[model samples]
Target: MKYNFDEINNRLGTYCTQWDYIEDRFGEKDLLPFSISDTDFKIPKPISKTIQKVSQSELYGYTRWNHEDFKGSIAQFYKRRHDCEMNLDWIVYSPSVMYSVSLLIRLLSKPKDKVVTLNPMYDSFFTVIQDNDRQLESHYLQAQNGTYEINFSLLEKQLKDATIFLLCSPHNPTGRIWTYEEMEKIISICKKYGVKIISDEIHMDIKLKENKHIPLLSFLDIYDELYTASSCSKTFNVPGLIGSYAILPNSQVKDEFLHMTRKVDFLNSPSIFGMYATMVGYTECDDYIDQMNDYIRKNMEYVQQFLFENLPDFHFSMPDGTYLGWIDARNVPFTSEQIQDAFVHVGKVAIMKGETYGKAGEKYLRLNCGCPKAKLEDGLQRMKKAMDWLYNNQKGGGPKE
Candidate 1:
C-alpha cells in the first residue's frame, strides 16, 4: 500500500486535546488517551496544500461569504453521496455544530419550553438546552438484541408536549445509523406534536460499511421544520478550522434562526483557507476517505475479535459509522471511576467514561478507533491485560450478567 498508516505520528506536544491535555484531564501524564474524537492521522495532502496557499496571502481582513463557497461543493456532495437535493438558499454558516444547535434552540423555543433527546447521546444536546434556559427530557435508547433501538412508544409519549427534538444521526458513541423507517416514525410523531427537529449529522460521512446515510430532511417536503447541522471537520480531520453549516429548509425556521444569530453578531466568516480545504475534501478526496474507512473498519474488527476471544465479560457492538466504539463494562467489577483509573493507571490506556453522555452510560466507555492499526492493537492488548488482572485478583467475586 502506498499510504503509510503504520508510523506513530507524534501528537503529544501539539496542543491536541486528545494528547496534550491528558495529564491535566486525567491527573496522569502517562494515560494512553483515546477519549477525544479527533483522528491521529495527518491532514490529507490536498487540504494541506490549500491551507498553505491561503496562509501565503498577506491580508487578513473582513471577509464575505461567497455563494460558490457555500453551495456547489456541499450541494454536489449531498446529492451525489446521499441522494439528497439541496439549494444554496437553504444553507447557513456557523462556526461549529454546537453553536448552530444553541442558536436554533434559542430561536425555535422559549424559556421553560421542553426539548427531547435520546439518552446515551452526545452531551452537547443537553448543554444547548440548558444554556438556552429550556427543559430537557430524555428517552433512553433500549439495548435489545445486542443493539440500541429507539422505543417509539416512549418517544411518542415524550414528544407529545415537547417543542423541539434533538436527533443524532449515526448516533454518537453507539454508532447506530438510523434507518429511513425509524426516521419517518420520528418525523410523524414530531409533526403530531408540532415539534421542530434539529438533527446533528456531523459524523454522517464517516461510514465504515455499505449503509448509506439518509438525511432526515429527505423524508419530508421542502416545508418541513427540520434543521441539519454538519461539518467537514469530522470527515476531513479539520476541526481546528471551526467551519460548519446548518441546513434549514423552512423559510420561517431559517429566518428565525438568522434573527437569533444576528442579535449576537454570529456571522462567522469561514477562513478562506478552510473554505478551500473543504472544497478540495468534498470534490477531490474520495479515494483518501475510502482508505480511511477501510482502516477504521479493520481496527474495529480486530477489537471485536479480541473481545470475543479473550474478554467475554464486556459487551459491545461494532460501530456501523463513525470511529467511536461504545463498550459495556457493567459486567466487570469496577465503578466508572475505577474503570477509568484502571485503564489509565494499570493499563496505561485512556478512553472516555460513558457517564459523560448520561446516567444510562454509567458503566460504558467510548473508545476512538481512528488511530493507526498498531496503536489500536497496543491499546487493546493493554486493556485485555488489565481486565484479566482485575478479574483474577478479585477478592470477593466477579460481576454477574
Candidate 2:
C-alpha cells in the first residue's frame, strides 16, 4: 500500500505515444487512447532510483551481455516467483522478446515454410512471419460465452504441415492462461510432427489467480521442442527500456540462434539502462508485483461494473491475466470500422480495433485498463455516449444537430 496507484502523473510533454500522439495516430485531437498495452502508471520506485543512480555516474559504455548479475537475477526471479528452476546457461540476452522471436523464426524455419499460430494472437506475429518471407497460418480459438478454448483436432492438423508454432502464454486480447493439459496437448502434437515451438511468456508475471501462469520452460523435461522469450518490460511497465532474454534448453538450437544473432550482429551489445532496470526489477522489486496485481484487479472490476451498468449490450469476460479487457460488441449491428469511428470521432476515445488481432476479433474492442480510476471512468463515459448516439441515430430517436 506504500506505492500509490491512484495518482495521475502528467505525461503530455514527454513524447509519450499513449498521450501526446493520439491525434497523429487516431486522427483526433481530443481522443483519449486506451489501446496500447503499456500501463499509464509510474514504474516502481526502485527501478527509477537504480536508473538514476546509474545515469548520474554518466558511464554509458557498451554493456556486456554476459554479465552474471543479469542472468542470476533472472534465474532467481523465476525460482522465487514461479517456482521454476532455470540454469544460467539456458539464458541469452536479447534487445526485446519480439526481436528474439523474429530471429527464432528465421533460425528454425526456412523461407516459405508455414508457421502456425492461434487467431487473435499478438498482432506482431503476423508482421514477423510475413516480413521474414514465411507463410502465416492460423486456427481460430473457439469462444463460448466469452471464454476461449483451443480446437486440438484442428491444431494437430495444422501441425502436420507446420514448421513452427508461435504461442502466446496468458494470451493477448483474450488473456486466457493456458492450462497444463492444454499445453501438454500442444507439446505432444508439435513433437509428433517435428514442429518447433516458440512460446512468448512476457505476461507470465501478471496474473489474477494463483498458479495460473504455467511457465512453458517448466515443460522442458517432457518436451525438448520448445523455446521461450520473456522480459521485465511488461512486468515493470518499462517497454521503452528495450531488453529481453531467451531461454533455450537444447544446445543445438541455442547455438543456431546465437549463430544467427552473431552473423547479423543483432543483439550484440546490451542496453545500458535496460540492463540495470532488469537486474533491479528482478532483484529488488519483488513485492512491487503483488501491489501491482491488487491495483490491476481493482481496475478490472471498475471496467466490468461500468460495462454492466451503462453498456449492457456489450459483453466482456474478466481476464484471468494481463491488464487488457477484450470486449465483444458484435451485437451492436455495426462493422468494426464503424465502431472504431464511433470510438474515435463520436466518443473522443480510442481503443484497439479487433481486426488488428485477426478475423476472429472482428466487432471486438481491446481496452487497456491499466490507468487511473478517474481516467478509466472518463473513457467509460465517452464510450457510453458513443454507444447511445449509435443506438439513437440508427433508430431515428437521436436529436438532430
Q: TM-score for every candidate vs. truth?
A: 0.94, 0.96
Clash pairs for candidate 1: none
Worst lDDT 10-window in candidate 1: 392-401
Q: What is the C-alpha lDDT of each candidate?
A: 0.82, 0.86
lDDT of 1 by residue, 1-401 (tens): 23555658988777888888887767778677788898988778888887787778876676655477656888888887889998878887777888898888888889999999989989777788888899999989988766789999999999999999999997997888888788888998998889999999999988976667799779767238888998888888899876788888878877776776655566656666566666888887877788888888888888888888887877877777999999888887677765666677678888888888997788988999989988888898889876776666565333221
Q: Write the per-residue lDDT of candidate 2 for residues 265-297, one digit (tens) a residue.
A: 666688888888899999989777888888888
Candidate 1 positional error at 192, Å: 1.3
Indicate the residue-level lDDT of 387 in model 1: 75
Off by over 4 Å in 2: 395-401
- Clash counts for the predictions, in order: 0, 0
Question: How does candidate 2 score on lDDT?
Answer: 0.86
Which pairs clash in model 2?
Answer: none
